[model samples]
Target: MTGVPASAAGGTGRTVPRGKLGTAAVNQASLWNIANILTMVRLVLVPAFVVLLLQDGGHDPVWRAWAWAAFAVAMITDVFDGHLARAYNLVTDFGKIADPIADKAIMAAGLICLSSLGDLPWWVTGVILFRELGITLMRFWVIRHGVIPASRGGKMKTLAQGTAVGMYVLVLTGPLATFRFWVMTVAVVLTVVTGLDYVRQAVVLRRRGLAAERADAAAKAGQRA
Candidate 1:
């Protein structure tokens, strides 16, 4: 029938494909955007930082100091990537997912390494790690429900932890001998409090389920009408 129409059945079936070369180019550019590249760089540096910290069985103060410096640089990158993503309009799903993962990995590595050195107590590290792990699991469980944006307290907690870690490292360098203990004590308090705050927020969100429920109800109503 009419030469078996070019697109009938399997004859080339060229129906002006949905994706164009230009669209593909845009997607590739987005994938390699500045924010995502920075995140990847952070991820790559984590293992190196860990290696530096663990290389010398905790004896050499010089190695310890350098390790601390590496950790600090990595943490700074953590802050920079987020700020750049937002300011330059380069935020992406990839950044959102990997940024926190990178933070947790670096923190966990530091805590574990320092704990092994007796600079940090096991119980203290245990508490912090437990909170971090617990909250992360809770987030995943409730991810389908709704987004739970970060609180001001959470941000404060991060700042406190970073400051405490830096100070603790400096103490190892023999600079702030007298005040180091006090600094760490304050850091521990902030960490525990912030962790509890996150748990409380998660519980509240679970009880309400307001955002997800509202969206679902709206969709059903539209379908019926």
Candidate 2:
């Protein structure tokens, strides 16, 4: 089997197995990789998106369209960055932490801006943001145990939210407005349900992690005796 050459292993004059080296390389993926760059682009777009969104009293269709463009770019990048990271083994600690923060930042900015403009009710924003913030905290809470891979339900929730928020960002009227309201409703429901599911997963993960630590400790003690 192919292996990492000695020169690539700190010039130690010893080759390393390909499997182990590949795993280590992935774990140490550079911060400057395409995945992390896309994530940073999303982060940069948030402020620009907000500026476009709130421009001209937040009612002009033209400016709203621009804001929606920015938002769309941000959301599109969100999908690609994660896919690229996982597919190409470009996942890094920075990507793991920043991707979610960028996701929440863009969405939170859009929601707060819409609420402030009286376009969306504050209660809806409150509900979605609360769930988002709670889930994020829960991720950090169990982070020491392991990373939580995004579930199918979580992907659905994100799609629902992006669609709903995108619609709201536009100057829809009459029937379209009503449709958006329903979409937002679904998004909100998904948000709550997925949040609860994540909480359950976090609890289970922490429990297992703790149990494993205890088992390791016992094994070490037995070995010593």
- Best model number under TM-score: 2
By summed lDDT, the worst window of 10 consecutive residues in model 1 runs over 1-10
Q: On residues 1-225, what C-alpha lDDT tens digit does candidate 1 reach at each position?
A: 223334642467543333453455566687678778877877877788767766667656677677788878878888888888899888777888898998888888878877887878888789878888888898987777666787887777777777776666543435565466667677678778877887788788876786678888999999999
- Per lDDT, the best of the predicted structures is 2
lDDT of each: 0.75, 0.94
Report the lDDT tens digits of candidate 2 across residue range 34-133.
9999999999999999999999999999999999999999999999999998898888889988998999999999999999999999999999999989
| Total backbone collisions for each predicted model | 0, 0
Residue 154, model 2: lDDT of 94
Q: What lDDT does candidate 1 reach at residue 30?
A: 78
User: TM-scores for all candidates?
Assistant: 0.80, 0.83
Clashing pairs in 1: none
